[model samples]
Each structure stands twice: as structure tokens, then as C-alpha cells.
Target: MPRIRSLFNPSGKMDKLVFVDSTKYGNHTRRAPRPGLKKGEPALKRQFSRTKYLNDLAGELNSAFRGIWPAKKSDLYQKMLKRFRKEPENRRGLLLMQLKSMEINPRYTFNSLGTCSTTVKELEESVSVGLQVQAHPPRGKYDANTYYYEVILFTWDDPNDTAFWSRQYSDWIRIGKDYPNPVFEFLFPKPSGTTLQWLLCLRVHLGVEDVVFPVLTTTGMQITDVGTFDKDEIRILEQRKQEEEKAKKKAKAAVDDIVRVKAKNQQ
Candidate 1:
């Protein structure tokens, strides 16, 4: 019977089997993940439950800001503001995520994250607005070939606010989830005739559509100078993007036709 070898040298000229010291050639161990780096299930539940009432409020606010600045008194903002002020309790620590380019220019690809809190704690509010988008393979309800995503909006304000612990998110949609982004509008409670500066952090998960994982986390800010917004601009930008995409497809088709003709001649 032949016995299996415990150790062997590649030289094949050993007088006897020699033991090799594995400890002499060791690799570094990976660093441990930071605390709460990827932990937030209970947090998500709190966020969803608290925001269930705010969904309608958000829609109304978005509609109010849909058109031009210096809106009329009868505008949606005025109507919604009345409703906001009448609500029983004020919900602070609202973290907001917005796709900036969709409101500006398509060539611009920056997104934004911001939060709202007590005026006295403005600095804390600015520092705590960090949110990230994460993706997972299509599962259950996310049955399309496209990957499903979870966007977590974090705030450092009063830990009591459910949203302070949970993440706010949008409906899972395939459209406007990629580059050449979507027009995003966030509505927050603000006093009339005031300008406030907020610090924010935005993290985009790159390569999610292709099953690869990487994230780009950035910090910046935006100023809310007025309550009015122009919805017409968004429509114009969307039309422009559609036209540009059509032009590119036309040029590619022409090139493909030329290549096919050349190949036929060669044959």
C-alpha cells in the first residue's frame, strides 16, 4: 500500500521529507467592518412606519414646486403649507436625497443628501445627512433583470424621531435609476421668506446594475433660498435628453450599415 505524503519538495531530490514553516510566509488578515457600518433592520422599520403618513405630504409638496418660481398665492405650496402647520406634531430629522443633475443639466452627475432639524442645531443637522444606495440581485417583487436597490437616508438629529433611526426610500422602479438621471424634488418644512444653508453627504453605489459593488460617498451642501421652483425646466431637460439619445442611435445605425456593405463586397 502507498502512503500519502505530508510534505514534498518540488526539486524531487530530497533524502527525506523536510517540514516547511508555514508561519514564515503569512498573509495579512482583513480589517473588521466598523460598528453599525452595515447594520439597520429595525431602523428601516421605524423609518417606513413614520413616513407612511408623510408620503401624501411629499406628493403634494412636489406638486407645489413643480412649476415656476414666485408662484401664485393659490399655488400648491400655500395649500400644503397650511396643512403642514396644522399637523399635530412636527417631525424633525428628515433626511432628503435628490438627484441634482435632473434639476440642472444632464452633463452634471452630482447627487445630494440633506436634513432638517431645529434651527438651534443647524450645524448638527448639516453634519448628519448621509445616505447611501445599495443594490441586490432581482428577488421576489424585484423580478426584472435589473437589480433591486435600497437607499438609506441617515440623520444624526434627535434619535427619538423614527426617521432618525430608519431609512427613507423611493418606489423600486427601473427607470431613472441609472446615469443621465431622474428629476428628484425633496420638500421639507421651512419658514416662509428665509434662506438656510445645509451640509449634506451623498453616497452612490456604482456598478450595481452589473452585479459589482462599489460606492462613492461625498459631502456637500445646498441652500434653500426660496419656496418656488420651475417644473417647466425639468420637462425641457427631459425632452433634450430624449432627442440626444435618438441622434446617437441614428449615427450608430449608419455606421453599422456601412460596415455591413464593406463586408459584403469583401465576400
Candidate 2:
């Protein structure tokens, strides 16, 4: 027999759902702007990504009982429209601040110490005398040339916090007579003070170090290390493997003794 089921649902309404063909049936390509551009688009559209939805909302609010409702600019709806055009910033603008320092302050001191280094033989001679790679027409963009210098870093914080890192300016850059030293600068889009402090402390005690850039951030002072890992991590792995090998040998020897005793008993 043919299936006999209700044409309507239990709610006594027609069991209906609007089915949409998600696959393009018509000119869907004309709906959006060209990639990588918002040129010549409406200003409101440029401001808000959901321009279509926002416009629809505005239309719905205005269409209420046309004569019964009054049109006024000072209304709450207008205020909402203004917000739609441009949003306000949060009280706390950003968590991280970028660094900026065309010049390094040699007098600057932190964590109870100060130091510098470079590729030039003369710079590494003493703790105080750091060799600034003279602008022998330093190569690269704006001829910025700097070398890496590694060191140990240590740090702590109140209550709870992550560690910081710091390393020597990787190399030196050519500066005018006005600026005496080749200032070791930092990277951009820097971390917050809390984060930077954690990074700077890395220089105090890590096998490898970073070249940090001083940056100004929404979250306050920050330093970004420009260093890589060191050989110490590799040495650690080797030590662990040796310990495992020793344990394995001890287990094998015990198993051999058990086998030998069983053979003797059989004899």
C-alpha cells in the first residue's frame, strides 16, 4: 500500500520549510566588490563589513506605522546609525605596543647590569667597550647591519608572571657623527610591559639570546628578542637517551638469568 502520512505536522500547520539552492543559480558574482579593494564603495559600506545587514535593520526600524511614527534626527535610531558608520575604541586600546629607538641609550640600566657585543674583534674585547660595526657602507636596506650576541637572563614578578628575554643587538649599523654608537633597535608590534619583561629576562640565563627592539605599545613598554635556540637543548636530549639505555640493559640482564635457571631445572 502507498504510504499514508499526515500532510500537516502535529501542530496542525503545513509541514513546510523553505529550501534554498545554495549553488549559484543566477548572477551571484555581481553581488560583491572586487578582491583587495573597496574603491568607490559607499562610505558606510567601507566602515562596516556587514553593510547589507545594517541597512536592512535601518529600513525595518523606519517602516513602523509611517504616519504614526515621527521622523527625527535626535532619535536613538540615528545614534545607532552614527555608530554603524564608525565604532569607538575600547578603554584599553591595545595589549601590545610597538618599539621605537633610532638610538640606543648606553646609560640605560636594568636588572642590575648593562652590556653589549658585536662581530668586530675590538667590540668583544671588554665588557664596557662594545665595537659598533662602523658604517663601512653597511649592506642591506638602509645599510642596517648588526651581529648576534648571546647571554643568560633571569627574572621574576609579583604574584604570578611569565619570564622575559633579552639579547645583544645582533649587529651594528652606520650612523652619523651626531650619533656616536650603532644603536641596536627592536622589532615592531611589540609586547606589553609584562610580556616584554618576561622576554628581556631570557637574556639573563638562556644558552641562546635574542636581538630585542624597543617599542612603544598600547600596553606600555616592551622588548622583542631576536634570537634562536642553542645547543644546550640538544645536549639535554642526549642525556635523557643515555638514562633510558641504562634502564633497558638492566631489564635484559634479569630476563637472561631467568631463562638460564629454567634450562638448568629441566636438565
Best by TM-score: 1
Best by lDDT: 1
Native RMSD of candidate 1 (Å): 23.4
For residues 1-267, could you state the per-residue lDDT of candidate 2 as single tens digits? Answer: 954544542322222432322233421222333454664467645546455444543343334212211322225344334444442321010111111110112122121122333221111212121233333222223232332333222222221333232234334232234544444433312233221121121121111122323321100111222111223433544675899999999999988778433566675
Which portions of model 2 show Cα errors greater than 4 Å?
Answer: 1-159, 170-250, 258-267
Q: Rate the local accuracy (lDDT) of all candidates.
A: 0.32, 0.30
Task: Give the C-alpha miss distance for residue 46 in model 1, angstroms.
Answer: 51
Error (Å) of candidate 1 at residue 109 is 16
Model 1: residues >4 Å from true position, as ranges? 1-187, 193-200, 203-229, 259-267
